[model samples]
Target: MLIRSSTPEALRQNNSLSVLSALRRQGALAHTDLCAQTGLASATVSAITAILERDGVIERLEQKPAGGRGRPRVLFQPKRDCGYLAAVRISSDQVQYSLVDYAGRLIDRFEEPRLGGDGATQAFGQSFLAALARLAERSRLARDQVLAISISSKGIVDPGAARLVWSPVFGGAALDFSALLGAVWPARVLLANESLLVAQAIAAQREGQGHIPAIAALSLGHSIGLGLARRDRHGEWEVSAPNFGHMQHVAGGSLCRCGSQGCVEAYAGFYAVLRTAFQVPPQTIPAKFVPIAEIDKIAAQARAGHRMAIYAFRQAGQSLGAGLARMMSLFGSMPVAVTGPGLRFFGLMQEGLLEAFAETHEGRLNGVPLILPMTGEDELVFEGHVTRALAEMDVMLATGQGGGAP
Candidate 1:
């Protein structure tokens, strides 16, 4: 929000944000190039850069000789040591941690098994706090050096509270990360759905001209997750993770972990495929967790032309395709990017997926495009955390609100 009348100070802050955003997006740039890209006057650019350098948010490079006749010129870029960011990716099996610098470079990372015992949330919280301490100690960074801690999980996130409302790992047990981490770390605590981060990374990657304005990132694994990223009419990036995995796929069908019947995840999740392949009763409660090796074995069997194995995959694909159809109907036809470890089985599900997709209203009228680009899921998630974390940090620094609670 802006003032009804633009004040000189407000204009200056806005211009500073613009310059930082330009540099962050395009890397280092010369003063003239910064003015050209930001559409700011040369004088304004100089003033902003001078303040940014003085604040240590940005730094100047060694002067480079002009190609021909002009005097030597200097480039400006975000200072690598300005602040640090930590990314924590929580999955069903394990929790992964990544440390990144202000320049968005990965500094270090480690993973630990996500043990589940009594008081699962409390246990995870203790482990998370310890991990943060370890990260800071190992990296030799002071407590205040960390600008933000962005955490992602496969679950329902209360974005307003930076909390995990529900997750497969700890169903119905809400974890208020903002309050939990705030007690220990002074850095900003942020929470997002894992799939949403995937969408963010994909959106940032395609920010170049001529790219799609919106996209849907579908993460398939033991559970399914959906993240949609789109630019509003004002061209501001908005991202969200809908509980698409829990959307009903078949009424009164297989039981789901959420105590519901016929949810999309009940049919398409790894456990569902296993249950169907093994001829388990539809009413049987799903396993709390299904191992990746079990799913891989089923994939192998499906590839070997085993009728039951193939049928299980087909059923899962049908559920996914139907869910995607309904989603496109509501969100318009946005290209979907399928990711996660489960993509390895895409070949087995392609037939049923495309077949069911074609049967949908949007599929018939709009023809949904499915894009599968090869990339590491872990890397994408981390990149997404960094992209959003750093961008948020820039807004804070520019607005003089850095290190404040939301």
Candidate 2:
């Protein structure tokens, strides 16, 4: 195996990290290919690969015979069982938790009902810890194997401080989750808003596919959430400013639950649509309607030429697209990803949303790509948390810093 006495600053700071990250995104790669991709010396790549294999972070696979090469080139991939991380997504309607391996694969998943009304925080905290314990047991993973526990909440998160700044869905107050979980769990805790995490997870997965200048993700659920990812001047990936849901869409269309007038959530959120659906004065409407299931039925009816359903979806989509137009203007155009419960009605709303976007967008920014209905098996928020945790671990290991304390 090749060896190096000292690694370059960039390589030392992110040596194995850069290599592993490249492999994670591109799958198995040969040593020469890694050096070419990461701009590291051939000796450095080999040494780093050896270190990673020794630490169980990566493993060598069988070499493919090359017709012209003197010897076959060895390939390497991330060891799927290197360790585990916990991902928790806290929303107004539910709490979803999962145990994921280093490769962002779900090992187990658990979900619980969200506490309604004002006293949801304490109830959610208790349920969150309980669910985590149950999930760990189910996955048969030791507590120590859990290198980190990352949470994605509906509100703003200060990753540096590991605290919630404010969330309209949860009471408008900063929550000290680090202190709260510290009293119970024995693993490093990380907290980020759901929107940012979603964007990060998507970017992490899409790395090296091509030069995607920027990506935007819009989540349509109980509350509207937006995540934006772009590379900064220094060539570092950065998550943009969030809280796009609160942006005004109409002058005085509807009252938002956040005590704002004409916000996007007032028209695009799950409850907003359901409230409109229930107000149709139907004498036989169900007492309780599941928004997702009901929305699908409504979309199907709209497709079949139901005027009322079509009208409602159109209005909601117009309002949503207007909000997106504002984001497009500020970000100077990029790919917009529409996801979550709202996408179920994409067929009904596609035209209205496109029309509204065209009407509101001032410039010729329409050429920007837009991704609709995010495609992935695991919950995007949960996968995002797991990705963040694993990336953090990689950084710490490369820098020779110990893992964060519980």
Per-residue lDDT for 376 in model 1? 85
- The CA lDDT at 200 in model 1 is 93
Which 10-residue window of candidate 1 scores lowest in summed lDDT? 1-10
Lowest lDDT 10-mer window, candidate 2?
280-289
- Which regions of candidate 1 deviate over 4 angstroms? 1-5, 66-71, 403-406
How well does candidate 2 match the true structure in TM-score terms? 0.81
The lDDT of each candidate is 0.86, 0.71
Per-residue lDDT over 328-386 for candidate 1, one digit per residue giving the tens place of the 0 to 100 score: 88888788888888888877877888889999888899885665644588878888898
What TM-score would each prediction reach against the true structure? Answer: 0.95, 0.81
Q: Pick the candidate with the highest TM-score.
A: 1
